[model samples]
Target chain A: MAKILASSKDAMAHVKSGMTLMVGGFGVCGLPENLVHALAETNVKDITLISNNGSVDNWGNGKLIANKQIVKLFASYIGENSELAEQFISGQIDVELVPQGTLAERIRAGGAGIPAFFTPTGFGTKVAEGKEARNINGKDCILEEALLADVSFVKAHKADKLGNLVFNKTAQNFNPLMATAGKITIVEVEEIVENGELDPDEIHLPSIYVNYIVKGEQYDRRIEKRTYSSATS
Target chain B: MTGVSKKERIAQRLAKELQDGYYVNLGIGIPTLVANYIPDGMDIVLQSENGLLGIGPYPLEKDMDPDLINAGKETISTLPGSVFFNSAESFAMIRGGHVDASFLGAMEVSENGDIANYMIPGKMVKGMGGAMDLVAGSENVIVAMMHTSRDGKSKVLKECSLPLTGLKCVKKIVSDMGVMEVTPNGLVLLETAEGFTIDDVVNATEAKITVSENCLVGTY
Candidate 1:
């Protein structure tokens, strides 16, 4: 079993600058805050960050965005970060706006060792300008390549010494895929239990893919979006 | 196809046809309007392919929850039991066909049921969002928009020459001029906006249209 670290900072010691990193999260949910904070303290720069959402303002991947550490971002939702928007609009940063499902498949395929897959996400628009398209069954499907990363960061609920991880509810986002798809996978779990204590069926991600496990710090369970019914309704 | 001044009216009519308890994905722009009107009591589920399901539309300026927002990067709220997910898990539902229906907008739809939405003649556009997944993965796909472009060119064509979003994925098209269904047989004219006929719609379209027995133009 690989050693478990006490903090994300120690687990992230394996990272280097200018490497492509995949961070798992959808907006604010299932975000790896500890690793993000750890990455923040590092002198690394010029990272290509891939995720579903660029964290809002001063949180999640927003930490990297705030530090101006990311050189490129491959994401579905880019509007959350005004800094990203400014950089994109100013041509200072590289941005690839992939369709949400297509982005997921691209990341998954990359980790699965699949080179490329075809889809109809952006077949005939600006997204398809330089891409190849083949007609299958009279429908136009475009080819999009896979994505692999130098590093992957994931958040989970629990993990035993063997590194098998279990995530609760919404935390089961890109963590599993990122676990398998990267050269170095860093996981932050709320709890680390005794080896063999977790049921095999409950293990969302097997130990083989995770290179490092860090016990997460206590958290502030902030709600990203709060929509309450009308007060008078 | 009726004039451009009636885009919102057609969408309003389409929103009226929605049933309760359906999980729906609303595409950008006009389809987003479907959220503004949800008929008070229908329990329609709204999914945004960027990774949010059951997102409430933007609240009024004074009522805006600073944290609430949809995948479109627009502000929104959540209903009870509404859980937040990572980007990966949210998309799995979309690609796996968990979404019930999706309301979309299009620039062109063909007689053969092809959609040309994400492209224009010469503009440099980017971002496809989850239009493809929503169209391919959802059960029912509804397109809402005007029947023709600003230059008097009809969006209903014999074949789509622009770009394609999804193939034969559009189930219904609700336009200011009329409402049509994409059947295995062909495009069936289901209903029309006020004062429009099958011949009138055909004259404005590039492809052939089949008129259904239940066709009725909208009153508003």
Candidate 2:
């Protein structure tokens, strides 16, 4: 059974300076907001953050970047954060811009105990620079090594006391995969049920992947970009 | 000269390439607009790299689900029989070549069919989302973009000066000025927009192009 942390601080305490951390989310959706803020409140520094996007200027992992805690970042997109752009340009932070699919596949490979795999995604581009390539099935593929994290922060819609997680809709995107890729997976969920409460089939991630659970605070669920039209009005 | 906007013209031309029951991915920018012009009753399924299959048009505000977003982070709705999965599995479908076609936005395209859109040396860019994978794995790739930059520079060039997203991977290009095909012979002018002459297009293009005998004014 995963330990249920009493507070966000307690849950975030596992993170330390100079650790490689993976935070699961796409933009703002599915982010462990409480855990992110908790980690920011700490004095940890020289962190390497891996995520889909570095997040927008004031939210998600961006807060950590703003605090100058992140020494390096690995993500597919960082356009939403001007701070990251400045830091990257000024050589304040090191950045590795991986193709989105490759990033996800790398993490998935890590969890599957696969050391490395070949992918056709970045072949023949700057993304393929300094990487090994081979012809697989008449197509060019570059070998990408697996990505593992010291700790992973994942947000879920529901979780059982035993740590089985069920995510909400598209928010489920990276959380389930990140859950598997982390050595210590800490989940923040809206609700926590007793063991066996979550239907086995409904669980998006198994308990074996989760090491800690923290019932998250009420989320604002902020929309990243709000667009309204007459049809909706 | 018609009332159709330039953006709509490009999208309309690109939408014609979609086939019934085809699995397609639309990149951000001009490519994203193709969703609006999808032929009625066509059963094309749109795949978002974020794990959504059967992507539909943007949802109304009242029915908006904050959690349901596209790769662009825009709120969207799903169609009947829509399925969602984790990002890894979604990408598996992409890298496995399950997608039939993908329309992407390019900053520059070379006569040799190379694409450069992910970065511009020093300028701020969103970075390659799944474009590399899309171009590498899709059966066909169509590029949607403006014919030229705001400064009157042609985007269709002899060689892409910017960092390439993929090399010699683009099959077709739908731009504001014309529709072109990338062949071993070089860039071929397939169609020109209405009110635009071959001379007008030729003057703006930096790459050498062969005009097809059947080239006509764009229908859309």
Candidate 3:
């Protein structure tokens, strides 16, 4: 059974300095806002953050970057976060840029107990530099090791008392994979229902992967780029 | 097409290459405009690497959902047959070669079909988001870019001077000047954009291009 926590601050009790943390989101879309805010309030430092993209300067894990809490970052894209880029270029932070697909597969492989896998994604580019490369089936392939974390922070649309989670639309990006990859997974959800209210088949993540559940009090749900069709207007 | 910009013209030409019922992935910038020109009655599906497939047009302001966005992080709508999945599964669709065609913007493209777009050494270091995977896995890879840099330097080069996103992967190129195919020997000039001639394309290209006998002026 997953422990149901009441506040994001309480959820931060399990996090510590110098830990490898995985935060789930694709930019600001599916980020766990309250949890991130609470983590920013703490004095924890030297975090090695892993996510798909570094959100803009004032949002998502960018807040942690602004606070100078993260010492290293592993992400697919950092073009949106100017702060992270400055830090990376100035030798303030260590950055390892991975291909988006390879990042996702590495996380998934971590949770699934796969040690490493060969991928053709970064065969001959800078991404393949100094890696063990082999020609498989007449195609060049590189071996990428699995990634695991000390803790994971995930955001979901709904959760049952049993910790079964249901994500909304594209918000499901990297949450489920990070949930299983963490030693302690803390999930923040918009709503919590009774255990039996959710259908077993509809659960995106099972209770076994979640260690704690927190009801996020408020969500900014900020849109990174708000593009609208002029034709419809 | 008289008042159309070079970027829009490039997109319009690439839209014509899309086949019916094809699953395509479009990169940021000019490639995103290709969505607006998709041929009518064609059942093309747009795949966004952020985990949505069957991407429709940009949403009206009132219908916007912050969580519903394209890989560009712009608010977007989903088609009737759209489906959502996790990042791992979304990429599996890409890395498994399920995407039929991928249209991407590039900084430089070599005569041998190599692409360099993600970074420019110390000046720009925007990481390769999903480009390497898309080029390595998609069935057909097409680059959409300008014929020359702002400084009058040719982008179609004998060898890419920038870091490569993928090697020997690009199958074709649709530029502001013309349409070219990357063959074993070298780049082949297939068609010229409206108002451009073979001499104009040859002058703008850094690599020598062999003009095909069947080359014609593009309709757009």
State each candidate's chain A TM-score. Answer: 0.94, 0.97, 0.97
Model 3: per-residue Cα lDDT over B1-220, one tens digit each: 5888999999999999999989999999999999989988988999999999999888888889999999999999998999999999988999899999999999999999999999987888879999989998986999999999999999999999998999899999999989999999899999999988888898999986899899887655
For candidate 1, give the lDDT of residue B49.
52
Going through the candidates in the order shown, the clash numbers are 5, 0, 0
- The local lDDT score (0 to 100) that residue A197 gets in candidate 1 is 94
Best by lDDT: 3
Q: Evaluated with TM-score, which candidate comes out highest?
A: 3
List model 1 lDDT by residue over A107-223, tens digit each: 878878899988756665556678898987866778999998999998888999889988765456667887788888888888889988998877777899888888888565555
The parts of candidate 3 lying over 4 Å away from their true place are: A230-233
TM-scores for all candidates: the values are: 0.73, 0.97, 0.98
In angstroms, how far off is A11's CA in candidate 2? 1.0
lDDT (10s digit) by residue, model 3, range A1-233: 78999899999999999999999998898998888889999999999999888788967798999999999999988887889889988999998989999999999999999989999988888899999999999888999999999999999999998899999999999999999999999999999999999999999999999999999988887998999887645
For model 1, how does the per-residue alpha-carbon lDDT over B1-220 read when each residue is reduced to its tens digit?
A: 2453475676677787688887777777777777767898778888755445677645554565333456544556667756655456666777667777778888888876777765453343344566766776666878887788889898888788776776677888888788888888778988777777667876787767888987776554
What's the distance in Å from true for residue A231, model 1?
A: 8.0
lDDT of each: 0.75, 0.89, 0.92
Measured over all alpha carbons after superposition, the RMSD of each candidate to the real structure, in angstroms, is 5.5, 1.4, 1.2
